[model samples]
Target: MAVINNDSSVFQRIPNELANSIFDFLPNRDIKNLRLICRYLDRHVPLRFNRVFISANPLDVKVFLAIANHDTFRKQVKELIWDATLQSPRSCGNDSDDDYGSDEDSSDDNDYQGQSRFQRGCREAIEDAESRLVDKADGNEQQSLLDNLMTSGRALSYYERLVEEQADVLETRADEEAV
Candidate 1:
């Protein structure tokens, strides 16, 4: 026999606003699932889902050019952050000796030049990306760029977390060393 209650409503009933709020914080994969639930619910999410992230990948010029040419998803991108792992060869500024640091002032000039060159290269890259934005390029190019962007972005965030952890570890080690 089937059991029936006259005062029954819904077992899993949640307020729409509350549900949307909860769903917003869910992972991207879960969000995809949530979107499949209903079109009304999917409309609540922002457009950021369409844009991709590529943070730390060592990208070649061609790969960079490709991402700038994507069609449907490209227009949704508000900003693109390229974290090229370009660093100066000299860490002499971090040296403890003041006199030695002062003596190596010329090295600072070299570092400045290196930095300017790097900045120029980045500017050129941005220009190139912008130029490719309107072209009817190969769809594969955009996909490759999207992959690189996601991979790089993930790697950068991972490294940032690792650096924070390392800092904490160093502090603990220093305390132990001092003791």
Candidate 2:
């Protein structure tokens, strides 16, 4: 039988640095499980799983948001993997003839009956993530991951060139428009 007690000896046996390293590679779900194991472990897991890779699926976003809502250690995610070529639906109408399934109409009150539930969950998650970021920023002197990426020399130069080209294009367009 395993006993749960606050004998520092239990955790002291494992080195803190090693524990953090182990925690770093864990998937979000596993990380949450490990956190529930003990308070000492909880202290080490950062809020919002800071250095995460979001892919094409919105489900990843949903799960991350779900976890980030409750975690105190996660920071405001600095890098978002934006799909440059994401496709949007051309029409919102429900197609009953489709083979798989049909979507409910946006105007249907029954379809939106659970909307408040979804909204509440999303709101709570954002608020929690915001709080964690504010707390972390207060103590850290280093630039956030987002700031560093935006201001780096290569990125900065690229944007500057792009802006100059845009300005020239805009000036030419204005001349044409005047004519």
Candidate 2 residue lDDT tens string, 64-114: 455446555345555544333332322335422333222233332121222
Candidate 1 lDDT over residue span 93-128, tens digit each: 533432222322443111222233233343345447
lDDT of 1 at 154: 45
Residue 13 local lDDT, model 1 = 64
Error of 2 at 95 (Å): 6.5
**Candidate 2, residue 106: how far the Cα is off, in Å:** 27
Best by TM-score: 2
Candidate 1, superposed: residue stretches over 4 Å from native: 1-13, 47-51, 54-79, 83-179
Worst 10 residues of 1 by lDDT: 108-117
Q: What is the lDDT of residue 21 in candidate 2?
A: 77
The whole-model lDDT of each prediction reads: 0.44, 0.46
TM-score of each: 0.23, 0.30
